[model samples]
Target: MAETNATILIPDISGFTEFMTTTELSHSSRAIHMLIDAMLNAIGEEYEVSEIEGDAVLLIKKGPAPSKKEILGICLKIFNAFHSQRMWMQQYTICPCGACKAIINLTLKFIVHYGPLVELKVGRFVKQSGMEMIVAHRLLKNSIDSHEYLLMSEKLLKQVNDSTETADMVWGNAFEEYASIGKVGYHFALLNEARKNVPAPQAPQSYYRKDSTPYLQTTIAANFLDVYMVIMNIPGRAEWMPGLQKVEQDMPDICIGSLHHCLFENHQSTISPLLMISSDEEINYAESCRIEEMNISLVYEFVFKKVDEKSCHFSVRFMNAAELPIPEETRGILLENMQRMAEKLKLFCEK
Candidate 1:
């Protein structure tokens, strides 16, 4: 209703244009989508995503200004999530595709500005715009001289007091000019160095069946039992699952207590074993444990609902998704793989 204080943040993917042109179209889309999804997950539910403009996401947080520790904490979460996701991507999904392989070259940076802002609901869409928002967006195209950085407006720095400053909090001031706004001063915080020892996110929460929680659900056009059977056959999943080079069942019969080992993408690395917990005609449960960068324990749940004789609703969810950093992409990659598996299964079952 009235102008209120807000923080506008833009996390942009650097060198995306080149990534798109050089990598395979599908792979480029998947890789970029994964990275962006990871960033969005890192940002969490704290801020509102006003819009996604190309390779950048515009985030706006409106309310009383958060304290220096709070704002810095939020920034560190985003930075750690970004870094963890990137490194995890390289370690897992060891594919040779240009897009999959190109993550090593990708980098992320954020431009944040805090000031007053007003919002208007334009028809079905909520439009957020203000002088401060423009400043945040314009700051993205700056000569910061660094790719992995967090640029904060001087207005924000004023709120960060001396006690809150840590040894790694090295910031340098700069200025820029724009029409209407004139010259605006800002500071650059080296995101990587600033987040030297932030605690990584671990310990996945209990499987949230709520609408707000992160999950993937879809219906597949295939026989219900047939779909169930396909997923139940864990070893055969490598054919449809992405980055899966091999799946060997350590315990035969595929029942409760069955252990399935995995070799990812190539023979270079191995994933945690899949311990079957529940197995039924229309439902299945399993757990995957591994220590890559950090300990990872992912609980897998699958449900098959019959739509009719020829088609059915097949949904899979990954919960207890923790023990490592940035569980966002773990869920993301699993969801993506599930979608593809459903498609391939539909194609196969219909035949």
Candidate 2:
């Protein structure tokens, strides 16, 4: 048996569960096999796929000094292949609802490292050992759990010079601890660009309605408010208000239990007032309170009048402390806080 050091590549599908749940068993099985075939074929062109570990495919290439550029290019090609298959599934497959969600809407994580390739004499078994493999496995695991689109180690990055395309594409430092791998740092890379030749999927225009009850809306809002209060330590009775107490017992129906649900669903829920308050800008006219201190409320509503057209409007209003019956001076403080919260919400929804 010949033992040598080489780069190991691992590529795993992202939305395996989504595909299995939505696709027919036979179709799902075929898709999985096809993906594996495509990956193995692409890797076979430049390296040997030593083993297929369930959903993940591992490849090894013995070197004549393979550059980081070469490794990145190979990884990109593998990603493109997966992307192509995903498009095919979306176009041809039918789901329970006559519409199929993409199974390959996943990204690949690559681990490129150099280590000793050991072969056991008792059997025809070959494996990699030492710090390189350990680092690679650790990095790969971390990347998967973090849902990173792509991840690479620092040692992997240094093999390529700054002038290289790989260096230019690296956006920013990834996980600090991973980036602090000193000679073996980790970074993320996106694969969508490499598949430019492939047609992109059309964005779905249809909207699905979840719940539209005021109680749900208020519940969602209270959840968000609690989080905000905890983070900022706002000095007020709002943290211990009876309305918030009621909402706490009943969790919000919104996704991730966020007040953003009210915005996403529009103000159709009845409990929305408990969650949010709407007032006219006229309240600010007579009040000397700063905008941040006033109790300003915002409502986000989305409506789709046509199949391809949708309108999203966010309405903001300020409530006078006189109307809420709170202290006059506290009005400006509450308004300012509400405005800040609105800004943060805008940033989150935009993304």
Candidate 3:
């Protein structure tokens, strides 16, 4: 056991419980994980992430506490990152499911505390345990009126001062009682004003021209969601699309800015999500790809129309390839390959 002083910062996703319970599990789970990743990225190398507990991420910095400005800067960075991620996902999302649509309701709050930490090593993992740690975790259940805010423990606030030079935050004081620790006082600042500074998501890339005609179209004997699952499943692409050896991405779930390096039997292509829009009646998706060997840019577009509760009409086209002046024989070969792939996709979705 190593006993030392440390600063504990927990970034908790608010409304996570209701969001997950009420929304579609498959999509909601992915959305939450992606938002958490955004916060982790913004935190960068400043703090050590101790553990992730469901909707909360526990981070610690051993020895010494950061100044008020430093902590506020970190919190603002995380807030911006979180909201920015949600904005982009909401803008380009193709899934009209409950989870994707309800993402806008999810928000964030942070708890900061400074105290003695007991570093206990169990197996390969080290756990931070102590009365202060308990106090920090307990503070999460406080009466903070708003979902988006920063709450600093009395001990920490004393060290860093309660008043901040950051003008946007609206500060206040509150206290929570626990059986073990009695009353713990804290100061909180609403982040609604800070969020106003978060930039809006950029427009989605337009890969396909409006006048492009479909090269092939088909109807899938499955619901819209089912067909979408099959299409967005990158690893499963090998099963339906021909010559696809493997697909790789840094993140597990697909989103607006996702980049996938697809390995084919004969060549490699870098592909990125271009456009995605969805509604009850119809859904649209597009991707832009650059073939390394051919040195040609191509856009793949898909439009899905709901035929009924159990079936959908799917149309696919290759756009912006006319500028490449692809030979007729090459275009024929490409069309044949896509036609076969579409048939296989339909079967895969139906199964």
Candidate 4:
């Protein structure tokens, strides 16, 4: 027999009504469809979408009660996906009205609970009505008024963890809230682990210049620039060269893409290529071509020349593409994530 498990329902919209009043109905409808598709794709195959309410979508994912870590991971993935879509949309001439507003528009609310209910199938009509479902709907509505990204029963939160830290990465303030839902009381905290994970931005050791034009400096130590370039073109290699112009043009997008990939993509092992070439003969032009074809852009290259028994001089160059500009908020998020990556790399390299 299938054990009764808790369900996680997320109802969200792009706040189209507020910002998309000028848009044609057909275009707005298509945009909602795309949003739904993106949500379904991100949540995996297990969850069943219950309904669509205007621009909002309701999704139900059935599973044995998820751990707090698992719940946090799922929420992070959803937020990251929404953030990416918002950024992509901003690139277009037509703004999705106020759809891109992270403060008031681009937010999602989730309601989760355990229930002893079953879906009723009546010919072509499907029924998923239950006390739990009703509660989920009510909570979603409450979330809108509360201005909170997530709301759950104290019972659910306690089942997930005794206590969790809530670090405000965006606002730089940690907050804790307690909730009483039904007969349960639970405490909730924001997750600010990302701040601890990111390394502080460091000064580059050397700056690259092309025809008297100087670009940002590069560092041997793992920094945002290194991680941004490496993961964007992961499972590939980078070199210092004058011909790589497109890579530079797409640097901002590439950085954003890498951030999206890291936060969303689930993989068992690291995807970066090993830099093991000790001699010039080991570097093959054909292999470089194959790597580049993988869509991995090498934005910077480090030429390591041995200086002594334990030190070396590193020469670095930025790739030659047009520079892409990101919004202040997006840049802030990237910087936070970059610091986290740097800390992790520091730990790994030490070992």
Which candidate should be chosen as best, given TM-score against the real structure?
3
In terms of lDDT, model 4 sits at 0.41
lDDT of 1 by residue, 44-106 (tens): 899998898868888888876566666667777776776676665554442335676688788
Highest lDDT against the true fold, candidate? 3
Question: What does candidate 4 score in Cα RMSD to the true structure?
Answer: 18.8
* lDDT at 204, model 2: 24
Give TM per candidate.
0.55, 0.47, 0.83, 0.43
lDDT of 4 at 147: 29
Task: Write the candidate numbers in order of decreasing lDDT.
Answer: 3, 1, 2, 4
Tens-place lDDT per residue, model 2, 1-351, is 557766666777666666667766665666677777777766666887667765677677776436666777788777767767667555433221111344545545566655556644546666555556556666665633433355655665555444366765644455534443434456676655555655455532222223332211111122232223222222222233222222221332211112211111112111121121112210100111222223433232211111111212332334332334546565465445445555554443334
User: Taking the tens digit of each residue's C-alpha lDDT, what string does model 3 give over 249-273?
Assistant: 8766576667788899989887777
**lDDT-superior candidate, 1 or 2:** 1
Worst 10 residues of 4 by lDDT: 281-290
Q: Is candidate 3 or candidate 4 better by lDDT?
A: 3
Give candidate 3 regions above 4 Å deviation: 22-30, 62-65, 91-100, 162-164, 200-203, 212-215, 242-271, 289-297, 322-324
* TM-score, prediction 2: 0.47
